[model samples]
Target chain A: MNFDIAIVIAIEMNIKVQNISKSYNKIKAVDAVTFEVNSGELFGLIGPDGAGKTTIFRILTTLLMPDEGNATVAEYDVVADYKAIRSSVGYMPGKFSLYQDLTVEENLEFFATIFGTTLAENYALIADIYIQLEPFKDRRAGALSGGMKQKLALCCALIHAPKVLFLDEPTTGVDPVSRKEFWQMLKRLQLKGITILVSTPYMDEASLCDRIALIQKGKILKIDAPQVITANYEKLIYDIQSKNTHGLIHDLKNYSSHYSVYAFGEFIHYIDKNVDFKPEDLQQYLEEKNHSDIIIKKAETTIEDVFMDL
Target chain B: MVFETLQVSIIIMNKEKIIQVEKLTKTFGNFTAVKGITFDVYKGEIFGFLGANGAGKTTAMKMLIGISNPTSGKAIVAGLDVATQSDLVKMNIGYMSQKFSLYDDLTVNENITFFGGIYGLSRKQIKEKSIQLVEELEMQNVANNLVGALPLGWKQKLSFSVALLHEPKIVFLDEPTGGVDPITRRQFWEMIYTQAHKGTTIFVTTHYMDEAEYCDRVSIMVDGVIEALDTPKNLKQQFKVNSMNDVFLKLARNIE
Candidate 1:
């Protein structure tokens, strides 16, 4: 923790996405959305699939040219200084596209070579992470486990030690365990002062970031600390689980004050009229409606709620 | 040490022996994806294989289904040695790949017929099975549409139904529900529950922690090795972790 990797102290700490907008024919992918990421912060672009998370990422990483607005990464123009931006950023795309036929070590070496450096030159940078993959160094990249492949992709991304690291849903389909371990690895990488910008479809992962931007329908719904955004939630949430839980949605939607209700795995998350709602009142109401064993407890709002609200 | 803990647990679970793997390993060239780790899958139970990406779940599954040959050791699935009775094993087994294993260009009926024929089912049996599957999935309206145009969640449900077309003794799913809505994931599991009740052995692999908890028993792998094998509840209780994710994190740290 004490040793900083170059330590990247900056004079101007800011990123401005001024009136950025993009569309494909009539479909607006990014609709004049704008948000700034600090120089040394772990930020998240949290949203559902097709919510333009990938479009925003590609534009920021200088992969796709934006249609309407301007973007500046590390104070350099994304369009004019694309080469400078490319050399200074590390990106692990949502999909793993490394050479599948090559061994784990070979993949790392190939990535290092592409970045114009030898593994020996930057061995120290990746040693802590790479050593774990040493046992499978001889294993083909395609044959490495999901967790191992994730680690290998990460090592290659960090070989050049880019100033800003962009991870697009790095934990998309990885197991919960591997997903948890991967976050821990990101925290360690952050300790080295690497600015991280990650996108994910899972709302649960949003809480782990320093700050998150909840985007939906190609728009920025909200951007704040996970707790702050949740605290700002205006609707009252309840956990409505009971017999015929799947049928609860249609019945509840028939209620006059119900804001929204969506199934979230084991239980259903519901929003209702917050003005005069209480456990007993709702209980009696459901009872009158012939609902039995309804478990209606007030729930704190989550990032998913914010997106749903939008 | 997570790997060590998993290894110890798997050893104990194998004492009674539902699935017996003796030195089962898979390798290509100098690369070993699954390094000679043996275990067993119990009857009338849900067995889960948890691993990091490319950790060899797919390779191991391919071998168990008799599609790929093992590099060393031996595996007996449904009391039949995978090496000797490849066709016999296929007759008694159902498989679904991570890619959904469905032809996008083909209609639902076409896809069903294609697989049924491959499994050597009679024409009458295929027709009956197709009707039941379509009714169960509630996808009768889209039966004539190209499967490729369907959403991810719909495709997953259809794929699961298609896998069970012949009602084999066991069904194997490899991330069958990836990139689908959570609501869809729940419904897919419901279908799995109904099949398990009919005395079908279910073998699945997934990255979702919550999904792992649904398994009757599970084996965790690290570096092509089985680190832990136990029920989700038992593993969580033994590890003293709040969730399956923590248990996995604690175990993976040791391997790393």
Candidate 2:
């Protein structure tokens, strides 16, 4: 029985949280939050800024303690086994924390040395990302561009071959192209059997994760696969367009049946309160308001829509 | 009096160029940050300055706002030369950024009053403006509350309103809607529209492609150069892409 229990523990390397809560100055930062991450799963915590995402991250990484409840990472207690947890997990904070004055190569070497490892030992694990930074190895980290700096940070995080990786808002200010490239890198890392927990404010990134937890105001609104969350959205949204976008938004909000209206890309995403909403009805209303070049069609629901509705 | 009226009419008829730049360039040491970028912003136009990370957007913006001197170029902002009359240029423009703009320890009313005084408004004018500003934003309840205690969305809105206290001709916003909730982000854009409708030239920068679509015209920078500048619609049609995100990807990735 003892041997069997040991085997189960070895294979069940996952994260588990139960009713964890934290407060600051009597204001609840995280309130009874509970979730779990299976081994090798890419889990995402999606929310806007100041939604208690960073506090939860600090708690899980053993940098801070929860006021109540308990949690475990890699089958080790976060409070009792903090030393072990600290060695096994890699955490990249939302702010840049690397040594800015050191050269890129020096920063990498320093991190590797602290973990009692050498760059040669883990070259294969970070080969794909390090190649991009090879040319800038001699330059100071502060001199590197924003995208390059992020790549360097990720490389340092993986130097020890950590079992789980924690990334907070990695693409917050990155442009669309760099954001896309960053997601691709995460996908490749996940294929190597590393469990990843990432957070982002950009709602579109939720679809890229295996599973996501939509959080706001220190509470989880929903948790499920990205497809399931969007598929379960019950509202019928319409893509609205016209020559004068500003005027179109005002007119839609004034319509009697309008439930919600906001700009989405080039079109205004409109949701009607009526169950039997008709496209022709909205079309006629817009025409009467002198909106020309009108185009209305069924719009696909996204994570942003779900978040706003919640 | 007749001559003054005729001059004002002529300015209005000519489209009233609030900002005009010609081959603006800036360099530091051996690196050229902004390389001979040229563009014009008319009165009441919401011009989006976009680029990938470290694509010279910040550097270009600094020069245009008169804080950083250009290596070589000509930029006339509010009828003052940026390089020669930087102090005068600063007085004629309002600047705001997501990272820093408002003090955390000051109350909402204090911030408005403080910024009003710095803009050279008289004591009587500041008093009247503060009262009107507080009511306009519907923050009567939190007027005396410290800005640190407010939510992120509310702080952002209040910061925007404070920037407009002096009613400068042009407002420079650096990622104003970043990290705010969806509803608040739209509400912020509505404020922008209202300001533009009142003839305030808005020069803004953002990473959100959807926000780029709302600009009257956009300029995409790559490798310290303006690769594309046109209306979002025309750029999409030219690139044969469906959205501005695709247009940005094609442009940024192609250069890489």
Candidate 3:
């Protein structure tokens, strides 16, 4: 309504949130969150379960109203213009919510018809994803594999030709190979100029997004490029390994100079309280404990590491 | 520390075999869910069963746990044959399913009592064990709260602990750390390490490539067959990849 704000909104910001908050019973599901997505930008909400990412998606897709603050999708108010927002946004919920008995093509047709559009009208938009589903077009949706089910859900969401796509945990249970392909499809969709807002529990997928919001406990911890966030981690980290993996962790914890220690896949990531701590000292310490096959080196920080530091 | 000492003693007593499978096969009509797979799980080893979705990992796990009968082949778990002695095999293995088996509506202490009762533990033994378990998991403060009220991380840990209430020879975890945070996952792995050190064999299946690296040895399944089986290091070297994720991607990409 203000002149300055109106001018900023005219720049074609696809999605914007201002001090949004939501609660259920006494639990604060989403608390005072705010962010913006430019046109065609791929934004990610990265967090673990109970982090309120799903609540924000529900609010943005106009499926649920925020108890406080405001959000707009494609310049349409989420609260005042719920009907318009619904048509302009595509949502693939965390759970696979398609009709179980319907065939793949029938489900696609049903979603398209509900949106008052024919699949042929917007066939090109979903063509890349549909080709994968084409092989099992006659099979029932419930019989599809996890990866295939996700592709079909994505196609159904895009059938309406929405300006923005909202996908919740789209790759949570999917395998690594399918996860890579799904991101590839999203990249192609981004080229077509559709703003994407995806939520995922995998920290590795954070790098695929143009920008990400690291959220936890219903709070936004940080929002920036994944590279920027990890680079900003304020710590001297190292990846420690030894023949006795369990013994290594136990010994590292007992070390005086160690600050924070965590198990990261095959190795352990150790942060020292002293900035100039020597890796040799820790190596010698482990050696004294009879730990063999030692390999210790400075390690790169990841999104999950930065999130944990916060 | 007690576990570490116990592990040393177990090694001195000679490493035992907890699970042995020879030419395992399962079929539904013409569809072979498990196609003549074979492997062995040693005592106190963390065995990671890595696979993509629809890779028949669950079908194979079901047979090993005595829940589903294999169409052919043999599996000896806890020194008992899984084919003819399935009922006895079930009694020797603890199972924590993909969906963490915790009664949400019940209180934490109540859930413990319930699971303990199912395992046929006496009231006195359940009382003593629950006290030690709660203390070890650092959940004494929330012992009386509803299981649903606890955070996801705590619930997962509790579910794991409850699965081991009977202290079976091996624990079968199906995607145990799915959807958990990195910090919590690290902690869960620590728990797995602790459990293994105490002479319990860990048979876990996971979609996480990073987790595969943590196991003593891993078997990668593709289309109901074990295409590769080795330590994480050898798998990477054989595939010429940097990470287990790449190794899995390379293997899964080969499947039509």
Candidate 4:
């Protein structure tokens, strides 16, 4: 098979990434990114858009090389063991890439066959997902719904029973219910002792993992359990809504108590620049400020809220 | 339960919903993408279509929009049986996808004209609505720019505004917020809110859990079935979860 030089050398990586930095000319796509996922445990790369989540995933998955760094996965150095890494870890790219003309069953079987495995051998591992696609097993993958295709791709990933699973934004375009379902499946796979590393732009999905590394601009901002990261959140949060919401956002950002005021849902998520002020005091201030139809309530910090604060 | 503070009275109960689905099923071969899912979206409501990655929300939405056929059960969208009146349903509906159903090579104005023309709007109406939509979306700066050059969020809002050019009964959005920034997500929801106020039912799918709370009702799918369908508040109360993410986890995991 004709292949690129990097592809020929991608076999020996076993989770090693050194002071790796890469830039597309002047644009720092990934800057000094370094991390490792152990042999087993679902590791999440969580962040918002343009946070270089995909770039790092691609590099570790052996699809790209950093301008300067050394990395490995599954004891196979990403470069030296390129082919070995490619065959060992099951990967589902952010975009659906299965044969669109083939039915769900055909796609699964083709993938399993490629990996020299049969559906019966890995039946238990992929049973949950395959069952969802079973009825659509005859349906063209392209015709499958977003959620259905997601499940199909997941089943394909598990068909090989890989030592690791690399899902690049698997739930990005999926529905909330499906996102929940996908995460539950990941937990099950994690229990089976498969080291899984998934990247997502959705910070909310970070909590679903056992541990996470919050990355922004190709740098590791924080690495811990979701609850711990949120616990690291120091500012008091208020979900504030008013009759004049537009005016409220403009004013709250200018308010003396503003630590960070960003629009969250139907209200502005206000963080107190002055931590000493109580909720009632702020409410009183809003009332005194002639804020009409004001509803101010103390709000718990979510993963996204923490991301915003930090 | 979720968002019960919205203050629904008996008065709220009397109004008929625009899209009423009951036991809607879409089975392919032997697998069911959407199974026995039932929900109601009232007129002028910002109904959120939510689920995990493969939770049949899109299947259900596709059936409602008449793009995909349902294997069994009944779904009445915009007072028309989707199974029998697909054409009428299509005429009364506009759909936007996560990828944003617009011609990337076309100029913004040209894309608007193309979509408006397909919806059977008069040339004059197309021109007028394009100008109006351009003003509303603040896309005057990119009126003739190639849509591919625009950001994902701008294309999303533009797709939505284009979907409503003919005043559809309900607009179905399939993961319309994907790959967009949080600020853009907020702005898109604001557009949904504004359209809802104008009596356009906004049906949207999203992965963001916090966004679920904004829905008038949310249905959770697990293993190709609508396992939980209720207002976000009701699901929260039923599952004893503080946030929609927790509620989703409880139902999706506990079921197995």
Candidate 5:
């Protein structure tokens, strides 16, 4: 490539996808999805299972060929420059894929060796995580706990010091404390000028990302800054609770003029379709139905509410 | 004879103690997986067993389900001793693991039939219950489809329903909502609420703090010992935090 062309590519987006689609048989796994990740951005692919998050990750990593459209990682075509993309990106799959029989230190060493580097060469990149796994260095990967295995996998993925990181549901099944710590680690890595594309099913984790794309059933519902997406929810929501919680849901669903109703933790989230709907009227109605000790309050919309509305 | 009859009456009056444990402990070789933890699960109550990964929650759950033998102490689940009367305890309780328990290649109806048969259900009872299960989940369209073809949320709901087919006195859910979306998770909890309303004792373990709020009472295990046990509201107040997640962080912070 000429110097001018290389400069132009450098100015363009680090990760770009145009109308990428994939399918298994007649079922569409990822539909004409288009998105871009700017350089040094922490982008999130927020969606549930079977929403085609993995398919997009696979295409971007050059592991699977897309049936339609195209993608580029680090200004290199996923197909024409598959090897280049592979060397420039790190991928931590949802399932822990490390050698279970190998000790943590051995696993890290193996990955570093496969990348044609030693831990000493890129020790700084995985220093934060390695420190946590240091005590369990001699323990086999299979014998390690979920959080430890997660750290080990992340260490292996970062051993090569790729320019971009792709993590698919990195915190699923992990405890809340560890999940918070993992995101903190990601933030630290972001400061080091590495672009990241992470996917997760947890809605609360959306706020941690710089920007998020809510995908479902192979389509992108919305993509924007977390605050912007949440602020755009145009509904009057309420958090309601009573002695008979299940009956409260059943009654609200059947009650007249109510919008979406669903259980959220211990309380029920009810949306009023009519902008002028009053909480007192609903309270009166529930009281008539023998719901005592009822508590209802206007609630703020969250990323989950936006995703559900979409 | 009168004194003995009075003792039996006292035991019968405390029927709410569906699960009673006195310092349950389990050790794997030299490593203590579950320390001397004592707690009780009342009838028709949603009891949350919470902890971080490798916090001995799984080990404690295994002992209660009569799968793993305890090194010491005692546990009586559904009025049957877990150590000596494991078979009786097993017959009166249901279990749903974190991993997908149903066979992928099998159809939904077939999987239901298999589990129902394992619980010694008759053919007629299986048929009737299978129909009701499909109707309740609105899965009639996919009843004949392979379990593998269903989405993760649907599969999880199906797995939960299958676990309840036997109508055991207590149901143990080991992180039943792991990796599931928020909407589906809420729906699954609604199902749990319905089951609890119907008089089935629910014992569940999860790392999701929001889920911890849904339980009537929760116990937080750290390392091999339970660090805290109380209602979610009390726990938040005790830790001086606004959410259960913060409470968990405050507790786990002190541990190595």
Candidate 6:
């Protein structure tokens, strides 16, 4: 059985999209977007709002028809075999679309019944996530906290054991702690041999996925492993810090050799235009501008930097 | 140089407190959302209100904005008591949230005009402000476009500009840059800095820890209590962490 599963994983490309394009009122929402997800791999569509992440998900899940191009999920054509695709794939939209007036347990049971399955039969598939929601089982869905509501939504999405899961911006406005917990849960789900495709506006979450496509304005900027994308950044970024952050940013922006400057966490990320840039010259310049306690060092490039550069 | 020095000293001498709260508490039947929280916000300060999802940030914010009544506490905003002068409190401060701010059916120009009218701006002033705002945002071509048709980043920026139409003493922003792109998010911060430079106190909340570092001071709430409040640098040092994200993780680790 293990050998048979290995063969299935090796041969199956769980999701494939070939030049899918979608438009709304003459505005291109998804422009020639194409990518694939391997079975059991966690792929991330990383982008800000209105970057066509949702449009692509809708087309893949057979909710919306693409203007052009074709896509497949779990070897089922999204257009010709939408019903088959719907039954096998789990989708959690960006918005909370669950029945708010119903109790948590009732919502789960409802979803289970619609999928022609019993909650008892598939409880083990969502045991880890459902365990957290069990405490609020009797309470109405609308009365739960933001984090609890998100947990309940995730439980309903997983009620039926799905082969592939698609999550749309699941952590957009979520707090950092809850966001971290949500990603951990996704990792566990992937371990259960489920191919997961998740979209997020948070650049930090890109690194947690096996592969990420940095998308913006309905176009794919880059696609690769997070580390590979950062490694390919062909610039020597610098972390510059001083007492007066506002003044520091202003001075750095005015610096003649500066290529790009922006606030990154506690420090300002600076990239030099000149090839042979020295820290001493910049340090001397900042000191002249009355910036005290200047600290400059070579900073590591991150997925956010790459996205901004792209 | 002399005028600049004078302006600097004048600002220092006036260290005016725009918002003050003493033992602020709010309860819903048996549960206390805000448990006697106390904090002060000075004029021109960028105060970062940080908290978990259910840590009473919204409850405290509602009380400060004068939309909800507190069960017990003393709070003053713009020299008026929130409990007794909620109407005046509502007039003295601006508010913008990511979820709801602008009308989708209204054009950009109409939205600006509507907000200006609501703030009691003269018709002439509204016209002039709308023209200037359109030019500043480089939205002249889309001035007549419906707000819903505009991009998310543009909508956020316009929402912020509308909030400042009447030039209130304080502007409360709830997750203003939640899902915007990186460059646009920084641009929004630049707008915040410009308004703050003009002595408009900014009370903002966000999930981005990096943005937390940009604030002058930040207060983290946990389990309906103010767990820590300090500048990002000082908080990092106190917690022996290198970044604000770590400080937040350390403080908010108790919640599920």
- Using TM-score as the measure, the top candidate is 6
lDDT tens digits, residues B32-133, model 3? Answer: 879999988889999999887778888899999998898999989999888888888877889997575898999999999999998889999899989999
In model 1, the Cα lDDT at residue A112 comes to 84
As a whole number from 0 to 100, the lDDT of residue A217 in candidate 1 is 65
Which scores greater on DockQ, model 3 or model 4? 3
> Who is ahead in lDDT, 3 or 6?
6
Docking class of 6: medium
Model 3, span A108-156: residue lDDT tens: 9999999999999999999988988898999899988788899999999
**lDDT for each residue of candidate 4 in A27-96, tens digit (9 for 90 to 100):** 7878887777765667898876567777877887789877888887877777777898888888888888
Taking all chains together, each candidate's TM-score versus the true structure is 0.76, 0.95, 0.94, 0.76, 0.94, 0.97
- Candidate 1 per-residue lDDT, tens place, A200-246, comes to 86778899999999886688888899989888877778878655543
lDDT of 2 by residue, A78-118 (tens): 99999999899988999988999999999999999999999
Error of 4 at B221 (Å): 6.7
Model 2: residues >4 Å from true position, as ranges? A1-12, B1-14, B254-256
The root-mean-square deviation over C-alpha atoms between each candidate and the true structure, in angstroms, is: 6.6, 4.8, 4.5, 6.5, 4.8, 3.2
Candidate 6 lDDT, tens digit per residue, B75-157?
Answer: 99999999999999988999999999999999999999999999899999999999999999999999999999999999999
The candidate that achieves the highest lDDT relative to the unseen native structure: 6
Model 5, residue A259: distance off in Å is 0.4
Candidate 5 chain B: worst 10 consecutive residues by lDDT? B4-13
What is the two-chain DockQ of model 3?
0.69
Interface DockQ per candidate: 0.26, 0.71, 0.69, 0.34, 0.66, 0.79
The residue pairs found clashing in candidate 5 are: none
State which candidate, 2 or 3, has the greater TM-score: 2
Q: Cα deviation in Å at residue A89, candidate 3?
A: 0.9
TM-score of chain A of each: 0.90, 0.96, 0.95, 0.89, 0.95, 0.98
Each model's lDDT comes to 0.79, 0.91, 0.89, 0.79, 0.89, 0.93
* Clashes (candidate 2): 0
Give the per-residue lDDT of model 1 (tens digit) for B1-256.
5896688577656544435688889988887888998877766677888876556777888898898999899998877889999889998888997565899999998999999999899999999998988887888999999998666678888888888888877899888766554556766776776687777888998777667766778888877888898877678888998667777777765443
Model 3 regions lying over 4 Å from their true place: A1-13, B1-14, B254-256
How many residue pairs clash in model 1?
19
Supply fnat for every model shown. 0.38, 0.81, 0.76, 0.54, 0.84, 0.83
Clashes in model 6: which pairs? Answer: none
Which candidate, 2 or 6, has the higher lDDT? 6
